[model samples]
Target: MEQRVDRVEQRQDRLEDIVATMGELLIETREMVVEMRRENRQTRRIWIAIARKQELFDDDEFQDVFGDE
Candidate 1:
């Protein structure tokens, strides 16, 4: 009976350790997801700016910038 109790206690300790590790992993994953989202927004803004610049350069007033057709 005493040996059985000791085994149960050990199992509980192991489970507690696993839960703590999982919690830490979850927090890290959440932070990584947030960072990725921020990077995606920054990338989109850069692309939009580049597209606008391209449009400006395509206008008739800026045609000389590209030389003959």
Candidate 2:
């Protein structure tokens, strides 16, 4: 019975460690996602500016709106 209890405690400790590692990974993944979104926004802005310059999008209203991005 004592050995069984010890084994249970060891398993519980290992489970706790795994949970903590998963939490850290979740936080890192969230940070990476945020960074990627920011990069995508910047890339979109550059593309729009290029298109405007090339006159592919020749609406003054669109120019006014995307100019702020």
TM-score of each: 0.77, 0.83
lDDT of 1 by residue, 1-69 (tens): 999999999999999999999999999999999999999989867765675577866556444544332
Give me the displacement of residue 30 in model 2, in angstroms.
0.3
RMSD of each: 8.4, 2.6
Model 2 bad stretches (over 4 Å): 60-69
Quantify all predictions' global Cα lDDT against the true fold: 0.80, 0.88
Give lDDT tens digits, candidate 2, residues 1-69: 999999999999999999999999999999999999999999998888788788775577676767655
What range of 10 consecutive residues in model 1 has the weakest lDDT sum? 60-69
For candidate 1, list the clashing residue pairs, or say none: none
Best by lDDT: 2
Residue 4 lDDT in candidate 1? 100
